[model samples]
Target: MQIDFSRSIVDIVLDHGNSIPDRTALIFDQGDGAQSSLTYAELATRITQLAGALSARGLAGRRIALLFSAGTDFALALLACLAAGGVAIPLAPVGRRKARLQNILNMLGDIRPDCILLDDSMAALFGDELSAALAVGPVRYLEFAALAAEPHPFAALTLRPDQLAVLQFTSGTTSNPKGVMISHGNIIANEAMIQVAFGHDQDSHFVGWVPHYHDQGLFGNILQPLFLGSTCVITSPAAFINRPMFWLQLITRYGAHTSGGPNFGYDLCVDFATRRGMPDDLDLSGWRVAFNGAERVRPGTLDRFAECFADAGFDRRAFLPCYGLAESTLVTIAVPPQSDPIVKSYDSRALAAGRAEESKDREGVLELACCGPAMAGAEARIVDPATGAALPDGAVGEIWLRGPHITAGYIDNPAATEASFGRLDEGAPFLRTGDLGFAAAEGFFIVSRLKDLIIVRGRNHAPSDVEQIWSELSGTVGQASAAAVEIEMGDTQHIVLIAEMKRDDARALSDEKVQEMAGRLRAMAMERLELAVTDLVLVSASTIPRTTSGKVQRKQAGRMLMDGELTVLAMAGPLAQAFGPSEQGASAAGQSALR
Candidate 1:
């Protein structure tokens, strides 16, 4: 397949529509044995029709908010927005939660989109809230059916390389979500990078369940396959979460060549297999590239998943650990296809002190997964965040990137854009990832987010390191999640370990058992991480807040803990004194503290 790098995605789609009209473009698994698909000709027609309608409404070059669930409609809406020469802002469908509705409203306000494309279901769900929010502005509400059903003749608009294509909102794990300005050039360059890195071709097939609102889903799952004019099978994140096996089932059903999600996804699959067992007909031999990214890639997750699915012909070498962000337009560093993931054990103590010293001994060592070298046409540098000087290999520092794939800046936020995207002393522009890591000859190793790092008594600890310890200890109880956050109390920063126990475990375990588990967590943190846990709180499952991409929102969790928003099943340590005696008391105390 010959790819013209000079053309925009819109042009490429049109070319594919003409050349491979009967080729399958997308297959959506409904997760209930029902499925639907579209050919290149059908996809192109829908996109063009919708685009013509949008253009007729004078929405060109305007921001259009796509508020639809992950499915064929959302995909069509997104492509139409881009085809119409409008900036597509894909947001998750609004839910019943007032807070969630407000967040969507807040985002809409920030971008001030000219129109919102949704479906009847979404309108019925949050019509009142949306109406009230948009009543204050001139934003138009356009339904997907109404737009796609209208017949309109349209010619594809030629797009410039630097023209803004999409406004990708950050997950807001560390701070308020900012819209990353992704240009047409960035998309084309990134798609090319992904093609070379993953060894994808026109014949390559994809099966993905990651939400389209996420950068990984939008770029890696949706656009990457389209760029190669290949078939892509997609399912909703909810479907995957409800049954992790469905994801593998789709890959097996379609003999998918590429598919992946965050590290937690791999863990979920391992858990599912352990509990329910894999189907006898399951076969993953054709899955050539299982790219893991959008969050910290865990070595243990890769190991467990490979071992669990080994019987189904899963290849460990196919595991590709990647590192990327929306700011970089999806992927920056990714392991080469068919290569064994690099896992090096570094001295935990040395890592805490800003160095990646290889540990010969197994004890007290952190196994870091190497998210391979910079993508083609990209350069990665490890620099001291405080000093702005490039650091030597094996020294932990901020990861900076420079490449055509890198986004221009945040939308309408000059302050943040200035802070994150800037030029180096030598006049080369780079995007500061705000992630702490060290680069070795093999590849780049991500340590932790700069904002989420827990500093205690002059020692730095990654929350993931501590959370991993808790996860291992709590596995016997049930499916548990942990959040290790740093909270400031009277001029001192303290580590608060919050564990979310599965509902069954929370109900079955006595207070004594919960306290024992908390004590074990503290001891493990001290022994393994050399850090003292100031307080430990045990809460019911789903207590820890997470971003849309399933990353633990440590900053938000920390704030929630301070504000007493988390429901405490049990508390350990001195902090318990603040929440006197009972669960009800803790809630009242938290409310009072806020006042």
Candidate 2:
């Protein structure tokens, strides 16, 4: 069924809000450790009030920036913006708010948002620290608390289905960020896809500590729950990052039956569980659909997560492997929850060579896990990344997808937009995802992120290849790690390995001792992988600024290092003197253009 998104997302919310006024629509944790509840009626009222405030400021049909941390206000404000027929751009509210703020400002200069909405405290912070956040000049601005205080007023704002809803910016590999313009129709399509994929109903409840700014966090945790009239338990991403196991514990505590995250989340669960172990009385029987999406789903991580949580009533069948990206709003495919999660293993060489070769994954060790077929309207295909020729089954190539949920194009970037949308060859056009993968009857295998691939000396080396070696080190690092990548001098690729002690103590930084650890990593790369490293940057466990979804922004990490903010620099004694010869050094790295 086609949707008339002309009514805007607010219309959908009002429909459900009126019908489910009594339902526990939103359960949020007040940062101070207290819990707060907002029913459908209450949230709708908040949206109306916020929308009225925004309307008073003439924000309709204009682009608006939201700089927020997390919690109830963030959700309501986003929905309110949708209702007001404004294009919402949610940005990271952490870090030197100025740096991210300036980045957002630069983007707005291109798209030209009319107003910027920021945290009540952050607005004050910028007002006091204006010089620090120098990019502020044009555009109106509003603080969070101020908008909340405005009176509620009914407004009839219509939005076409294809009208831009949000500008979700994804970081470029070596360039500035690009914003994907998600439409109202795409939002509807993805919500329906997620609703169908999860096989849930109004009775379903979703709980999460995922960031509201991320596509997965916003789609799975906020939009899906609110759109379906399901109960949602929300918490700060910081709370979860600080304690990842709380994601699992929350499922048991609130009887939330629907949830998912990236592979690292499950791995973290295993890492935490093995060291701390699950609570003896933990009950995860209520979890009906525990899915993993938004990032590469590793098979080993899934297997170990099952092993660690087996005693806590966690069922392997509850895990559902899936695939998605911001271009699709959120979901593209999701396997139905099963009793025993299955992973299809293929010989690594055969996969890279664009052919199928079955392999035995050590009796119990998990190998490959394929994301299922396109959900609902989406169509998935494999095309050679370079030639744009469609590949047959069992052949590896770039993954191309198109459906109702696919974004129209990147905001304000016609070149990138046209280039990314479709490729023409032999009179056929297809969206080139840049991702390399292939289909295998039941589902598709996603090899890796296209942008993250490293082309060193003509050989493609996945950063994960080396990072895995460090991550798997015995009795050290654990899961608390950060891998920032930068091209060194002379066009040589350099990876800065950063890991803080699990105990989170600065005294743990014994230079010579950590150098000894770096030596172990250097040996693995040189002898086993034939790679040279320039430096190792070690920081406290939380120094690395991730996307709250565990995605390491290498550029951000490099900036931290260049600014002399790094905590520890561990360089292999050999390359320490050969920095001038590295390709990423001096002029080579700075002059090289991004592909």
Candidate 3:
């Protein structure tokens, strides 16, 4: 069942509708005991109907945002946009807060979509803000139900392979969001690469709860199944967040062959299993490929997940640690099926010097998991950030990639497009991933981002290192913590700790307790990292800013602190003295690097 890459995805799906019309294409769980199923023929017909309505409305070549809360509606609307020759923009449902709505407005200002597609329920949920937002821009709203009921004759799709198919908005970890311009050919090439990398076919069944608005969710779960002519069982992201067990239950019930999410998702499952335990009859023997992507893959998280579920016939070898970004259209590197994830140890000191030396002993070592080799038809290289020269294996540098799977550029942002897609000295085009990693004989080891690395006294420290130190005080500090830096006069930089207050600490707020916790944190920072903490700001849970993929927005956090937006529960150390270490504190600080 080889696919014709020249054909549009809509055409491929239509071919499936003709050859295997009765096959279950999509199974969506509503999370309320209600489920929806769509066969290929049924899906093709619905897509044709809605596409006809869109084409009648002259929406071809326009940008259309899909904002449905229901997975079924979302899938159909996305396909209809493609079939109608319009670029699809998958957006999260409108939130309630004014700030959230303002964020939506800001994105829309950049996108300037010609129309918005959503269901009636979402229309009601948006209330007056939807109308007001529409009034501000030249846009129209189309209800899915109404569009499906239209009787316009179906028109032939006019999309070309080079034409834009989607505007995938980045998670905004570095700055404001930018829409990655993904062409139809980019999707086709990546889908084929994923199939080759993951060993996916029509026999594979996928069960997932990652949000469809995300890159992993859109490319891995939803589109991969359709591209392979397979069945996809999907539930809302809220379902997994509320109860991660639901995801495992779906995999078990559906005999799903592939599934996965970020490292935090596995941590959540481990935490749930530890507290509530798993069902005695749960069976995960059919689960084959468990992909861990979209974030850092912690070595401990993999070990714990394996130990927790080994009793239920879950195989540790099924773990597949992978890495990619929206700029690459989803995945670039991935572990092959039926192989165990690669884990290695490196000297932390050498890593700061842009080298990856295998640690002789466990002491002062940093453990990293391999994200596998480059996918088929894709090539990756390590380049020195300062010199733009390619680095040899075992030398940490920026990850550069080149392949047909790479995206075109950002929409309406030539400066960003040029900056990210600059040419190498060898006269070859490569995408600068902005990630720090080193290639080894086994695979690539992803280190912290170049931007997220903190420089203290001319020493490099990953934010995770600082956050891990602060979160060890679990009783007083929450599990989530962010490490930020502020630069003052004389080119001096000082570390700032922003963390959530533990539930008990927030409930029993007192100046003495706050000061006590702050003092302990400062002491621990000095004792462990040997760095003087300038200030410790304790905030409520969910106050610290984070991207959609759960990565901390350190730059944004710094801005909030400077603007006095964060409610500070406690403050320690003199702000001005941060530039110059005090003699009293310097005398107390020891020589250690997070022992």
Candidate 4:
């Protein structure tokens, strides 16, 4: 169970390649019926060749940016960087759009990488534009074919565990992304932790469609399998988006023991199964440790998914709710393997006041699923965000983390790093997670982000609680909904609800019907959560802004609502009806709810 922290990841790969040269290391199912396989020896040779090529170009101890569009090329490029003693920086692929192109350029500016790896296909896709942009920069661009240019002596390369391995960029949902510096030691520790938590052995298999750019994709889909010396079936992110069922089918086909994504993925599967129905002859008895993380884990989604797939041999207990961030090297806490995820409801008002009192009233409560306890090498604690004081169990506060899995710090941002890494007791290095949660007898329960919590009359309310209220309308709520603070009528902030309409129903329903539905939603919010809704906007799908990983960007949606960027299909209630200038126009009861 102990990971040799003194050894680099490459050492593990070498041992596997030498011990099981003929064993399958990776299986690529492009989701188009095209498949490819790589053995341990074959993959090791390719990685060593590419590493040698990178070393020939003076990339050793320097940063190497990977710009491939996923598949064998992407995986090999990452391994090559580590093998060649270069820090790996996986970048978003180049696109013609000005914004995406600028993002790549901005990343390049920050990393100033010695070389950038571009697969043959992507090199041809961008052609002149990509070549011209790189021509002005000092960095070198190497094609995938260049990996064959006289395989250098990888055996002579020196590898260090404390050296930089990866620069994982934080998900830029709330702010501009910053690169987190992950040392080789961090990767080794986290990978071992994951192997233990998920029970991944050499015989275990993995199937996932997560994009290689995200932390979940890199750590959960790619690195963990390699660390475990197991076979992993790969597919593109577009594949899952195009057909959510294909992800599960791949698991069934490959007899994969582990596969999962964010809570939204499970919801997507349930939605698709409802419309398309489960495929005939599908079997999932072998599937285990269905991890749910990188976002809030919804218990309702878990229940719906289990019920929907129960006929296909799916087990509800396979659902493993977890909590993690890129800063902690992917996973900090995960539900122990083979255990059913725990869900509990708390008094909504008491939760707002930073207490975890069990709800007595069934109608007005906030339900949250536990992400389980801290991982093997890590410790998690709740602390007061304002005073850095440790909070007792059953009290909500910011979650602080300390472990070998934790990153060194943010790259080139001393002030931000210093502000993020604060001490709790006896000067222990704890990374301030900026997440609001509470620890109880069961485990850690994530309530919401500290910055994202909505405050009205000094009581904090989770936006998810309000969003879930509207989403309960089921047929009316589409793919996503957002509740945000709308600062209106001179500094007074009221909760603004923006929902996406189902595309099919939006086309058939009249404006009157939409307005009636919104009225119902407004009434339900008032009755259930004891909150007054100022304005409700029902717009078409894609109206509510979301991050690349499908998380609702509440701040961005709020900004879009204020700027009139979203196409408003229907609107209900006055924008400032809750706090209008004329006291006669406002309801006395609604005013009391606001207070």
For each of the candidates, the C-alpha root-mean-square deviation to the true structure, in angstroms, is: 2.2, 4.6, 5.3, 4.8
Off by over 4 Å in 1: 1-5, 94-97, 132-136, 476-480, 585-595
Estimate, for each residue in 1-595, the C-alpha lDDT of model 3 and write its tens digit.
2334688777878778988899999999855888999999998888888888898999977899887774777888898899888999988653456766676667777788999877777777664677776875598867788888888888676567788999998988878878999988888889989998999989799997888888988889998999889999999888897888888989998999999988878888888888898877779999999999887788878898999999888999999999999999999998888888788877777777778988867455677899999998888999988788999999989998988879988999999999889667565479999889999988788988788777765666666655666756653221235555543423445577777765566547665676676677767666544556666666556667877766678878766654445655555545423322211221111111101
Alpha-carbon lDDT of model 1:
0.85
As a TM-score, model 2 comes out at 0.85
Strongest candidate by TM-score: 1
Question: Model 4, 138: alpha-carbon shift in Å?
Answer: 1.9
Worst 10 residues of 4 by lDDT: 578-587
What TM-score, computed on C-alpha atoms, does each candidate reach?
0.96, 0.85, 0.90, 0.93
Model 3 clashing residue pairs (backbone): none
Which residue pairs clash in candidate 1? Answer: none
Candidate 3 off by > 4 Å:
1-4, 135-137, 425-428, 471-492, 506-535, 571-595
Q: What is the lDDT of residue 471 in candidate 3?
A: 59
Clash counts per candidate, in order, are 0, 17, 0, 0
Model 2, runs deviating above 4 Å: 1-7, 30-33, 97-111, 130-136, 171-175, 361-366, 424-429, 456-459, 474-548, 554-568, 579-595
Off by over 4 Å in 4: 94-98, 148-150, 476-485, 502-508, 576-595
lDDT of 4 at 430: 94
**Sorted on TM-score, highest at the top, how do the candidates line up?**
1, 4, 3, 2
Residue 461 Cα positional deviation in candidate 4, in Å, after optimal superposition? 1.3
